[model samples]
Target: MSKQLPDLTPIGVVAIAALCTTSLLVGVRSLGALQRWELLVFDWMIRLRPDDPPDPRLLVVGITEDDLSRFGWPLSDRTLAQALNQLQQHDPAAIGLDLYRNLSQPPGYEELVAELNAPNLIGIENDNVDPPPTLPEARIGFNDLVSDPDGPIRRNLMTFEIEGKTRYSFSLRLALHYLQLKGLAPEVSPTGAIVWGKAVFEPLTSTSGGYATIDAKGYQILLNYRAEDRAVETVTLSQVLDRQVPPEWIEDKIIAIGTIAPSIGDVHYTPYSSTSSHPFMAGVVIHAQMLSQLLSAVIDGRPLFWFWSEGVEIAWILAWTVGGAAIAWWCRHPLLLVAVSAGGIGVLVLTTWGIFLAAGWIPFVTPVLGWAIAGSGVVAYRAYQSGRQQQIVMKLLGQSTSPEVADALWSSRDHLLKNGKLPGQKLVATMLFTDLKDFSTISEQMPPEALLEWLNEYLEMLTEVVQEHHGIINKFTGDGIMAAFGVPIARQQPEEIAEDAYNAVSCGLTMSDRLQILNREWQQRGLPVIQMRVGIYTGPIVAGSLGGKERLEYGMIGDSVNIASRLESCEKDRQSSICRVLIARETLTLIREQFVVEHWGPLALKGKHQMVDVYRVLARQQKTGEVPVEPPVDFPQPKR
Candidate 1:
């Protein structure tokens, strides 16, 4: 058995490709780049979100710069009281005084406390301070905003239990207060989730998008900011205090109060705000966003932001890993594979965002990186693989074939090394046997070194012709050569086997013609001319590696090979010709019209039980063209 081309590249390529793909997927969920990309894709989705007109039921009343300039920095308690008294007359549903009045900023302290005691005035309190601010417990809520690590608010803390007291957020309390007047009070479900009217807010945990471990300390949920336009109907504190505000703007409206002064207002970042020249929204407006989302979820049936189950996300990552590996394996060319991978990434992003725009939270980063890792990694492995295979082929063929031919074989190794390794297989091939005529007589007349040099010249010429015809020279015996075709690489179709047959006969005839020209050159150089007889037999044969583990040679072993060798001896045909080429009838059937053949009839060969029909190949039929190579200047063309 001959040495097989070991499977080096394919298995390693698959393993490394899989490893790289998996690493990319894991990195996407764990690495910071993936998190940033997820955020960017999210921002794009937010930017593309359709805008809605401001809700008519809710109103935003803020202390604008004009109001601040009029009311003097921190408005005195009397000014706050005067604004409150004016709002009371309008019969608004609820009033959220977003400013913290834990310490009195007073010109009229007694009057401000009296106005603060009103049932609709919701005061803000801060828990971050050492001595937490005090408020009328019934009308107070914590004014705390939960920001992501990027310092932008995307989640809402509806209600948190602190020191056994269930404290609500500034927005949730304000919204509840407004809903209560309309006979829709906030209720807690048996599951401990807040249900505003009919909408149950699903809370966000640490596992929410890209949040591996977050502080989920409260009744937190994703905050979907109001659409692009100014969603809140607004009026300033000065307008309300000066009695310049229309009654209808405050009447029956859920009014939220905050300062819009860029200098003094509590500002925070939000999604919709990113599109503005000044992206920071007032703390009160952020709270208003929370309230609007809640009310809209209940009344308008708006969908809440949601994340995929952990199992589903893992499966998605795994799916992309496999997809990347498959694409890498199928496309081995580096540049072409990269282009394909780029196209794949583009499609993934477009499809992911398309689903996101439709309210589906599909991931984009993990999958695409998996594709690049698999694709580029596979391309690298195959390039290494090609170099290794080329080395092996060069090592095996030795100095018999040219570097160009070896490179050509390396480039097309996928055809030769099927499924990574070549296994022993039965195939149909042509075996050509060539022996120098009168070699014993010629060799005895020359010195040992001269005869050896003489043999090499003939061998080189024959080997080159065999390679040109895509045949493998197996071995040299004394002064004869044995070559086989369609070995190691099996032919899948019958037409391929016939082509192998054609190549064998063409190579034998070319060697004969080249030898006659070589004879003229030898005659001029005062060297003895030589003649060689060729025999070709085509049939079903077993062609593969042959020998022990240390020494190996690929060759064919069958009756066809034996028959071709026997015919090349010239003694079996009972002919006296100097050098003639004979082909078996089995081979003749495949190339009957392509050569000028003489029927030599059935003749029993050495070591064969029965007689087999043979034909002498006189000459090859020229192709249908006028130009012949060299124009036969010295030798006349042989006639049919």
Candidate 2:
């Protein structure tokens, strides 16, 4: 018979569970609200350390507290000129002033302006809502900070539109200044982000093209602070007015002179901020870092995106969803399921980190979560549905009959009903045939009502024994019962079914001994004593519904079954009477270790040409228990 599909309720439940899990994962990730505490821990663990060398070409001309102290409160313009003059001695390629010069202040302001007008100096500008025109000599660069959705300073502004014209800022402009210094000025892209002529310093590290992102401390480069006078051979504003400081100091190095006093507040947050360096110094260092990055690009070449992050994210989700579902379905245990889920998460994190570090790109996050959620959801749902179905089946079958019989019947009910026939279906089973020896004579000797009572009592005891061994009583003759094992269901090992048969026989022996006492009491009243013979055989049998529509019985019908009945009947015949409990050789094979059997030579039975080997089970050998063997060898024999 064709196998029927399993119950629908469980499948439905599993599908629902999978849907719920998918929805949850997608919802959480889309909102960016997933509390990734574990990811947070991982992020911290893998945070890059400081003191690493930044690109070397960039150089900082920091305006410090010492410069302020030496030149009076907010440093005067002449003092700035004097400082710039000293820095020019270094012969640096380019210089960037991180200070805004929109409005002027100080005695040496004009002199400072004259010095800034020099070829390599780049001045900072803010192109907020309104922007000033670029200086004729010095290149204007903007200093704009962009914040993340959570209000954290995470990105840098590369370009801004001022009055319908695009003006690039910070790193982009610094890169432009370096190109200008090489007489290789770049053409600006329409979007204001990319620089033409030279490849844009598009570090794959940042979401934006121009800037290389720094950690929260802000400094992208290590700050080497300069102290007063020691900061860079500082001279008084009067000394520079008198041309006392050497002209060589003001001839070559690109110089930046700005206030670093806490009161002035020119300082800003940077990654390299420390107890020694102020924020102004940090900004100066960042400017140097950007310049170095630009020069490196001009030299070593900029890195490209290794993988399309958007595509990666989508693929990850698909892979996780399909793969996770497969894994969850394959594993049934709760702990194993959890381990699989964790393993998936680990793989996802590892993949994300690997791509980020190696290719400098962030892969898609949504797809990975989708896979995991779908996988876990399906498995959990299936397990729940399975449990519910089991409960329903148990409630329906548990109390009506033997648990083993109930389980088997419930399991095979669909197949049996669909096929309409139970017999002729080959199944590995333990067939049991039990009969009351000389039952006809006993019935004839006793009154009808008394005989009926005695038969009911005998059947009840036998039925209990069969139930105790987890066997289903297939049918009962006038004074005989037949049971089966390993059908309607099968176990991992056939030996378990053999053990059940042995247990049933042992139970029968106990019941017989108990019945002996009752039979003796009946004997005193001139009634016949009752005795029974049982035979168990393990082999393939055809089991199904037997008889016509009105009265159908589920039973087995095959030669193995016929042999079992013959073996039981043999107990009464003189020639075959030596064995009280005869079991098939096949059954003996499974239980030879626990049972002691006397081999009964193969017999040629009626209607069968071939001889069948059989064994008479003498006793079950227990480590610490008695073997009950009644009905001595001299018991009166009956004709078969």
- Number of the top candidate by lDDT? 1
lDDT of 2 by residue, 370-477 (tens): 666677567655665455545443432223247866766655544544323333466677777888776777777778998888788777766776677676676668
Q: Please provide, for model 1 over 331-446, each residue's C-alpha lDDT reduced to its tens digit, 9 standing for 90 to 100.
A: 76668777777787777878787776655666666767776676666666666667665654544454454444456556666776543333356878888899876677888889
Every model: Cα RMSD to truth: 5.3, 9.3
Model 2, runs deviating above 4 Å = 1-31, 34-46, 49-52, 64-73, 127-134, 183-281, 302-309, 333-345, 364-368, 388-425, 433-482, 487-504, 513-537, 542-640
